[model samples]
Target chain A: MNVVVLNEVRKGFYLDSVALMRLSREVAGSPGVIEAALMMGTPSNAAIMRNAGLLEEGTAVKGNDLVIAVKAESESAAREALDNAIKSLDKPKTQGEAQAAWRPHSIAAAVTARPEINLALISVPGEFAAAEARKALNRGLHVLMFSDNVSLEDELSLKQQARAAGLLMMGPDCGTAVIGGAPLAFANKLTRGRIGIIGASGTGTQEISCLISEAGAGISHAIGVGGRDLKKDIGGITTLMAIDAFDADPETDHVVLISKPPHPDVAKSVLERIGRSRKSYTVCFIGASEVQLPANARFSPTLKGAAELALGHKQIGADFDANAVASRLPRSGRGGIEGLFAGGTLCAEAQVILAAAGRKVASNAAIPGVPKLGVEPSAGRDRLIDLGDDEYTRGRPHPMIDPSVRDDALRAALKNRDLSVILLDLVLGYGAHADPAEHLAKIAADRGQDAPVLVASVVGTEQDPQGRSAQIRKLEQAGFIVAPSNAQACELAVAIVQNAGR
Target chain B: MTDQDRPQYQQLLARKVEVVNVGLEGFVKDLRDCDIGVVHVDWKPSAGGDPQMAALLAKLGV
Candidate 1:
């Protein structure tokens, strides 16, 4: 086979990262194609292409150019893939074509066309997100930024501007939020209730909100304060604003705050602000050590616990029979547990639960007490890996958006005879993959009974586009012990490992 | 906090949610399916992704 490389530059063309990634995936899967990438010609993206050997040495391109690079078995294949990519790019989007004639090209034009536009959902590249968000704030709009890789300094300045203007800047990397009853990017369609949530972690918020909704409780509004807002430099500016907003809204009777352990000073100030609220608050700083709580606030260590508290109910998993679930598993060997998760917060929650059970679980996104996974294998140590970490997703799409990204790692874990149980999460919602469980189920089916006991959970509601019950049925039919929630999945995995004499 | 002391964003809760979606057109379907009013902005990197030129355009209010 004669290997050939080819490139095409669409001058001043632009596409969002997600679209580019999806298109790249299609091109790479074409006949005889080894690799393909569709990226903006930004400096970082150029470096990525260079490192992937898709770009020739000394190839110069402007940041606004769309770079289509492909490597294939033959020149014809490479040329075919390049042509396919361009055709896909030029194809008209069918979703909003009816309104295409009236569609605005800029924030200013959008506001001019619809002057009542109150929110801006910004998902541009990180280098440009701050500018777009700034433009939105200047127009008196609340911003929910779904973009990541933004500089901390840019985040600080943007948040400060939003705060000064009495507006909200939800994220530089904010993923999930529901305002009034409208579910924003990567959010769930939750029932309307009096419980308001402010979350720094996207998946953490989703887990808690879904749990609350599943428990027959609903949400008034779920505000996302981007992951870094509670750090020292940003100082929880959006968090404080969210608290004040919830306190003032008569519709919101209770508030839930979810995040990983925040900066100590930031946490202290947030707690103090929560103390002043008339409404009760449930704060779940996942994996954070105990801190003093105000009279109106209760502290929870897990997302499930926060949801249970907000709902005034006993543990949502109180009826979960871990032993019964474990007993049904076809355990073969005495081995450590392997957790491969797409949700970062779900992965951290599992690490916390495992660590609390006197187990040392190594993870890529480790909590306070747990240690990071080392390059060398450690004997008898359980491993929980967050596949969405930058280490695994620098050039690839997030596992949640493209579940195939976790296929190789999942397949490896399935074949590992030393693993007692392979734990996983299938997150479903608007922005996630269409049918993540079906994808995983196919992989597990390929390995047959030779694989370890597969324990999993679906983090979504029945109302989600990918029905929760259907996803669970797929996993269970594929021989997976499907837990109701992520926390319970961890518990079930632990029980299986312990039953196997770990 | 009293009703008057509420942060400016509290008022947003009572108003209808009309969104200006920047960047991805893929998100438009989700919003439309939810029956929320949305307008998509065909966004691209400004000034051909040249930071100096983009900054100058911003200053000029273009």
Candidate 2:
């Protein structure tokens, strides 16, 4: 085999994981290419490139360097394949977008051109967000921060400064929000109405808003304060602000506060603030057990219940039949679940619920009982790993937007001899992968039906771009016991565990 | 926020929400595509996000 190693092919800039994977597929399928791989010069990536014979002696590259290694039938063919990989990586996301020269030079410059800009949507890398947010706040603008990887110190300082400056700093990692009926990053398109929501979890906010919109109640606004806002340090700064905004808005007749279980002090602070609310509000602290809320605020333990309580309506819950799931428990092999989830908050909720039910759970998340998968990768009787966590997606897109990493995780978990049930969450929406369940079907197809029962849920409505029914159908076809919600999916998994052939 | 900033609390709630997306210019495109007013911040992390914060985080053992 003839190998042509493009040493330090592209440097200074990084290709996103999606683009990297797409480039590899494109190059591998090109003519005369026996094998091809394109990756950054990370240690793991360098090892793969070297082992695959895609590297040459004295090839020194940094993590930022792009390495394209190709092997072909001949030297000329290898060079040609390498050339194709470069072209694919350099290709434009959209032909028209690349051709269009309407790109602005900077934020201050863009604001100068159009002074109507009241809000600045900040999605820069985590470290730079504080500086950029400072610039926006100085300009008397509100910020919707969508970047993560920011330090807790910077986050606290930024939020404090925003509050002092009289501007809203939505997130260092906030993913979804709707302001004045204008949907922001990773938000669903919904009609304007009276129900307003503030959540610390992006997907949790989405799940509730989508549920409300589907039940014939439109959303007035939804603000995401990020996952860590309710922690002790940040102390629910944005959450309190959002609640007051919803309280003051005449358009928002009722409101809801959704989140993963918050820090005790933060929760009490928020609860005391809610005690003073004049308008009706519901609190769905996702995985919290029963809590006595103030007279004005009702505690909802589930996302669906929060939506239902906010609208003063009821719908039949999709009860996961424990008997039905138990009937099909794996007769042999491991009997515990190893849930591989794509949504962090959903994974946290599952851990919280299972822990409350007295189930042994361990994970890569920060839940109390669930130890970090890094420190204890194999501690839990049931291992639940949130593939969307930063550890898993360091150089890749989120699992929701890119399922390759999640698929890889699932395949790894399936190899475990003690795995009797596999739990997953298929969160579908506009910005999510176009057809995840279609992809899930392909991933789980190799697993024999009797190997382990698959339990899952699709956190989307029928109106999503990826049709809910179609995705559910694909999952069902893959032998997944599709539950109605994340909580139900956990219940189904627990039941499967309880009845697994001992 | 500190106690003195209670008055500024009304500032964010009083105004209409406008977004300035810093990195990932695609987010600006997405908001604009949805007909929501948005602006790109053309961000490169004043100190490049990586070296400065990473060095600090490493030293602080965060």
- lDDT score for residue A387 of model 2: 86
Off by over 4 Å in 1: A92-101, A375-379, B1-7, B51-62
lDDT of each: 0.86, 0.73
Question: Looking at candidate 2, what is the lDDT of residue A498?
Answer: 71
Label model 1 with its docking quality class: medium
How big is the positional error of residue A43 in model 1, measured in Å on the Cα after superposition?
Answer: 1.9
Tens-digit lDDT track of model 1 for A394-486 = 766789888887899988888888888888998898888888988998888888565788889888898999988999999889888888789
**How many backbone collisions does model 1 have?**
0
How do the residues A198-295 of candidate 2 rate in per-residue lDDT, one tens digit apiece?
A: 88888888877876776678888888898889999999998888877776667888888988888999999999888888778899887677566889
- How much of the real interface does each model capture, measured as fnat? 0.68, 0.37
Model 1 is docked with a DockQ of 0.65
DockQ of the candidate models in sequence = 0.65, 0.27
